[model samples]
Target: MFLKQIVHFSKKSIRLSYQFQTMSTFTSRTNIVTGNNEWIFVDNDNFDYQQELARSAFADMLHDHERNIQYEKAIIKTLQNLSKSMKKIHILDIGTGTGLLSMMAARALNQINNTSCSSRITACEVFQPMAKIAKKCIEKNDLSDCIRVIDKRSTELDLENDLQGDRINVIIAEVFDTELIGEGALRTFSEACKHLTIDNENLHIIPARATIYIQLVESSVLQEFHTLKNISQQNQRINIPNDCRHLAGNTIFDLNLNELKDSIRPLTKPIPIFHFNFKHINEMNNFTEEKILENIQCNYDGRIDAFIMWWNLDMDEQGEIQLGTIPVWCYDDQEKIKNIQWREHWIHGIYYPQESKIVKAKDQVSLYCFHDEYSLYFDVGTSPFPPRSFIPAILSRSAMAAFNSDKRRNKYIKVLEKSFSNSSIKRCLYFGDGLLLPLLILEIYPNIELIILQSSNTHLNHCLEAILLNSTIKLNYQIISSLDKNEIDFQTIDMILSEPFFTKSILPWDNLHYYYLIQKYRSYFRSNIKIFPQKARIRCLALEFNNLHKIRSPVKQCCQFDLTPFDEQIMKASLNVDETIEPQSLFEYSSKKPTLSSIIDLIEIDFEKNFYDKIEKKNLEILFIENGICNGIAFWIDYELNENIWLTTGIENENDSWINYSKQGVHLLPKPIYVQSGMKLQISTGFDFKQGQFLFDIIY
Candidate 1:
């Protein structure tokens, strides 16, 4: 119990707590696939990730296959009408893989037993093994009478004068990746259309136009390998710089090919394909390749469900022989035709985007071309071109925009377009504490080239826990120790931490492993209290109150404090120090094996924790007996304080009589111990005494 005073000061440390409460449960699912180098496909048990790979071209190719039977039927219906008198027809199958579509068309023509028109199917394949297999399939289906397979690429079509009937009337090929860039489709189709088609006849292009979409992903792969730089000091050590690459897994770029499809848009369009005055031919060029763009726009705006390019061919009113895109039309429900056997053409792509906007030209976004292993069948040797330099300024801006205001201010970032750098530079630096992820913007200030965080090992695991709990930008840590010199590389950084700074502040208190530190700094602020007094007849401590408690005048001689009889009673009652046991004792650290050396650390921290918890404080005056005994007083400091209780040393010598001095007034701040003597001593309070119940103790 005590009287108190209030003081003012600047600065305060406020602790606020927040938790990211999420309700989630865990369940395990299994996915397994097995195939030889010849073929590869993920078994059904797993989730489909085809679009995630190579622009989902594999899905597009697969779709072509699933539609093979229907395609054959469509063309057969047209063929049946064409020749009541033609007698026979010959078809050229280019880029024939697995013979799915070629075989289907062959059987359809053969099934009708046409005396008026006989048909022959010639399959041309680039890959030798696939051609050999298609040859066997012709024999297996008893279509050898009508179908003959050529073990040559489609580009070699111009050389072959053997189309069963001298000149082929129909051409079929399934070759379009999502970007329409894979499988050399352009070279094959151009040559076939030019050299083989009959005069004024149309050419068939299967799965013709492919629409591409670019997206961003949250992949751990890129982050770990992108930035590379090191920092160090001149004090004799070396450091290594390392980086990683990862994906954010979000779509930032989308492009459409509807115009490109309605008319043929070749990577490099040739004005004339042979001298043939093909019936209807319209096309466009100068469109983009598989190239990805960050901000994009087109003349028209649509969601771009997927690119659709079908057949446009020349046939008489009788539906006479002609060629064009595959007979199977594009299917909106891509998954319904999953099996490949009846497919008229292989499907390759499916860009089912999330949160995608139907953007027109000049819309800012992020995009990347990726290979998705999640597609049902893996490509034999397919991957993607190294991505063009990209950035996710949109995502970053969005995360920032969430704070303070719900409205996003992304319009300003558009200045990046006209003033963008044309030079392709990739200078990188990857040195930031995982503990401070959020401090990235303030500290980095757009300086880093790239940051790749290691997913399981470095980033998610090694992150500091305190930062995770207390702050959003916990990782923007400050340097407690500055470098003496800046030129030294930090790849092999090995610097000793400063003594008091490393000990009392840098490391968190609760979970530290400092048994050795306790040994090393036995004399400095230790971690526990082995050398401290368990029970002292006399003790002295000082504590500050203005910062927290607003307490003052702990000395018994402070006349400035007005203590009524009621206040005096409380102080005397509070003097029993046994009840003031701290919630956590220095001995509790003993169980954790804290040594005498580490025990001293408690002194400094206890000073901060208990500064003005109580109203009274003290100063060490002296230690003597009631009989006037004395020597050089000695005791140990259990904790540090600016104004606190003072415990006296047990009396050593004595001559007799004693007098009580606190009789003048009750102590409030910095309790001073004085042996009673003839000299008149009064325990008056110090400055800043306010009226209140800051009751404290002056224990014997």
Candidate 2:
């Protein structure tokens, strides 16, 4: 519970007080005040309130025990090595999120010699809100005397004033994202080496060196996310021209390595592409350097769909202590993937090429890797180009790729083919975001009259472009923003075709935009008008996925760190917001672990009936089909193209028709529960009419 008190002093002064309820889960103190305005009227210089109440991101970091354990071991090793030197150890810990490393260093030094108080640590946290928490953590661990929390980014720290004119002997920093250098680590290291850390032989960096590796793989499953696909065994009747070239690249693709290990097939062995040696300051140039790996022979005969990448860290000087992010299948011991030591902070990376490259056994290719300050780009070719500054290509290759997907084109072809079979439906009206439907309709029915209603002039121009480029058939179509009832005749329109999609659709239910339009235009259509999709339904099922729950809630602790504080902070920040439930492709994340319940229908929408009416709340009782741990609920939409033809976005079966082009959405339970066979689970679900969103509630 949270309570606020407003105390009004004279008209010019005010004091606002906030009291946050104590979290018993972690034994946090009661009546904790995160922010108060009492000091504002007195002195604001020393007044610092917690600015970042959201702690999910931080909780995620603390959940990685592999990272925490390795850092502890590294810190211990560094302190043991420094003990041999007569000079006192001055450690500079940068980007200390929880002051875990500083506390570890202090604990290690204290264990070695209780009488010696020479070693000191200065932990720097750029987020002042987080810095205060780091200070609390240090004090909680009884190491406040040895480690001092500095509320400033490393770059902002003045060496002379902040460090008391002292050069540091050791530097420990945790500041790398999935892209490795995405967090501006290059600049941080470049400056720290120049001004902060001593350039002496005794200086030691916790992570001595790091190396990035990449391999080519053939994965149609992975390509489905980046490019278009056609999965039917039969030949497609309609073909969208594919002419887009790879334009650019972005941050690394972080995923559950264990889930994708068996899904991807490799064409080449993992190759080391870049290495950064933190001990040697000059190695920082790897961020801006351009390099080429030439004549790499392909080991397998297959088409290379993507480049999978991972990096390993050498934590100690002897390289005896190291941390690797390689997936379980990559290791000799497959059990490692199931091990908790496999961390989440750093997962594998994937770089998708503009087009799939066909490679035969013994075939050789060259890979060119270029980088600017904070990102890496890869280009595959037969030879290397001269080193030059990186320039991002400006193109709509992604949009073109989406348009060229086979599965999507197949849906359009099947729908139009099935609808055209009705002899009475001659003229068609298209209402959608693009003109792809207009072009395709004209291709099949060359003599059919098509009228497209596009709201944006920009989209209308695109339609003209598609028509201009593919002029095989002269289309009888008119583009209009809206139908003026006074000036237009609606009697001739006998058919309506739509994708039932909207640009504002972030959630699956947002597709109601199409239904809302139909509700508004139902009276304008002829009595016998036929809609493309006859009906739509919502279906759901209870599932168990251990890895999926880890993203929503932490099941592992980082060493001896009390991560509950961070978890509590995050839960409070997200009290009113539904951040845990999200849209995901169940096809990519299915478990051999048995499901608790089969698919259950939660709601149904029959386009034949009135759908614009207020949605009535639904209460469902689902019996367990099998005994298993139920972690969440998976839901999807089913669109009935015709009476006999159906396209679904739900969980796909190996034997089912491979025409599901839509991704399913998931709603994770607040906590996982083990249900026995025949047990009934109660759930209530409905639509938030005002917010245009879906609401789900699980009752025990």
- How high is the CA lDDT of each candidate model? 0.30, 0.65
User: What would you estimate as the lDDT of candidate 2?
Assistant: 0.65
Worst 10 residues of 2 by lDDT: 27-36
lDDT per residue for candidate 1 within 127-161, as digits (tens), equals 55456546665565566677778877766765456
TM-score, candidate number 2: 0.82
Candidate 1 Cα misplacement greater than 4 A, ranges: 1-66, 158-165, 202-700
Error of 2 at 362 (Å): 1.8
* Residue 458 lDDT, candidate 2, scale 0-100: 61
